[model samples]
Target: MKLQNATVLVTGANRGIGLALVRALLGAGVQKVYATARDRNSLEAVTALDSARVIPLQVDVTNHDLVSRLSEQAPDVNLLINNAGVLSFGNILEVPVEKIHEQFDVNFYGALNMARAFVPAIEKNGGGAIVNILTLVALASMPGLATYNASKAAAWSMTQSLRASVSDKNIAVYGVFPGAVDTDMLAGVDMAKTSPADIAKAVLHGIETDLEDIFPDPMSTQLYAAWRQDHKAVEKQFAGM
Candidate 1:
């Protein structure tokens, strides 16, 4: 679906790539952007963009009841961007099990809840798009961030299933993978990172063209190419990173 004049709702809109997506959507001629975060106070920057178009909403995607309420609250929503994520760095053997659940709660289950809650609304509005901000790590495991990688991989698989389920509903599902984005999620990582703004722009472009899987950064594109050629080779390469 075209983003122009579309009503879009973005989760985790307080900072990082989510904030950048709100900005990019505005430039794309979107009619409204419901910028949601767990803490609405953190949405000051987003609300400052365009008071009329930027609607700050306080929402925790992990809350199933609250997410279900979105179908009634924002009935006009057509595009849903699942961008909220968490990263607790530790190897699978060393990381606290609760930490793994925490990451999955937001990264995987949260996205699933949002998708379920908004599907009816999106269908009502004549089917639009769902963009899941997954990671390149979804395709491979990084030893230090084993839990995060696992959570994102689950989300990646979920996105694929959602796409298949929604095939006849006219709703387009997009899975975005970017390697090492310059966001708080990668605070301590010392590697070449893509700007959130650039990733956001690329995502919008992908949506415009109805690209099913979007590789929004150079690293992601290269890694995807390698994976396509030899998945195991790329997996081994990332395991060492």
Candidate 2:
């Protein structure tokens, strides 16, 4: 859907890519943006943008009751951006099981909860869009981020299933596979990283163009191209990274 005048709800809007998306949405002239975070106080920056247009809500996507409440509270929401996620660096075999579970809770189940709770609201509003913030690792695993990769891969599969389920309802489901972004999530990563602002803008552009899967950054764009040509080769390459 067009960004202008659309009422949107963005989960995990306190910082990083979520914050950048809030900034981009406001700049894009969206009518109202409900910026949600696990803590309301953390949304100070977003609320400061425009008190009237940027409404802050305390929402932990993993909490089913809270997400249900939010769906009721924000009935006008036409776009749901499921951007909340966690990253834990570790090899799959040695990573703490809790860390793996934590990643899945926020990255996979959390997005699923948000979609389940918000789909009805969006449908009532004559259908809109659901943007699931995924990662390039969903396509291939990186050794150090194996747990995180697994979580995102599950999310990626869910995104596809959700799209098929909602296609008849006119609600567009988009999976955004971005490469390493320059956020706290990748604070010490030595690889080149794209700025959150650039990624956010590219996501908006992808949404406007009705792309089903968005490769928002240069790295992701290149990786996706290579994967399409020969996914196994790309997998082998990432395996050696």
Candidate 3:
């Protein structure tokens, strides 16, 4: 489907990549974009855009009831971007149960819940697409971010499963594996990170080309290439670090 004249809904649109996506879609000439966040008031940036084009909707994808309700309410949506994610740094074994649970709920299952809730709506709108934002660390475990890695890994698995499940329905599911991005989520982490605008532009380009999986930046592309060619080497590299 073309980005132009499309009605889109992006979760966690108040900040970070989600906010960038709303702007990117607008720049792509989309008809309307529902920029959703946990709190609509926090989306002043999105609202500052053309109010007629960018609609600020309150959405917490982890809330199943709200997800289903939004799906019903916005049955005409053509694109769904599941960008809502939480990162709780620590090993799964050492992190508090609550933190681990929060990570899983917001990072992994949150995307899944949104997909499940919106599949019918997307199909009803004539086979739109779903994009699940992931991370390169999902391909290889990282020490300091073990819990975050685990959550994204689970999301990667879910993305693969959903891709197959939704293919027949004409609902394209794109898994986006991006490395460190310059966003609040990666604040203070010392790593070469890509700009959110670059990633957002790459994602839109991928969607336009009908790419199923998108590596939105050089860092993600490099890591994904290594993982595909020498998974063990990359694993050992992270393991050693």
Q: Identify the candidate with maximal lDDT.
A: 2
Candidate 1 structure lDDT: 0.93
lDDT score for residue 225 of model 1: 95
- Model 3, 185: alpha-carbon shift in Å? 0.8
User: lDDT of model 2 at residue 2?
Assistant: 93
Q: What tens digits encode model 1's per-residue C-alpha lDDT throughout 32-77?
A: 9999999989999899999999988888989987787765778899
Q: Which candidate should be chosen as best, given TM-score against the real structure?
A: 2
| lDDT of each candidate versus the true structure | 0.93, 0.95, 0.89
Clashing pairs in 3: none
Instruction: Output the better candidate (1/2) by lDDT.
Output: 2
Query: CA lDDT of 116 in candidate 3?
Result: 91
What would the C-alpha RMSD of candidate 2 be, to one decimal place?
0.7
lDDT of 3 by residue, 84-203 (tens): 998887765788888888989998989999999888888887898999998889899987788889989999999999999998998888889898899999898888889989999999
TM-scores, each model vs. reference: 0.98, 0.99, 0.97
Candidate 3 all-Cα RMSD = 1.1
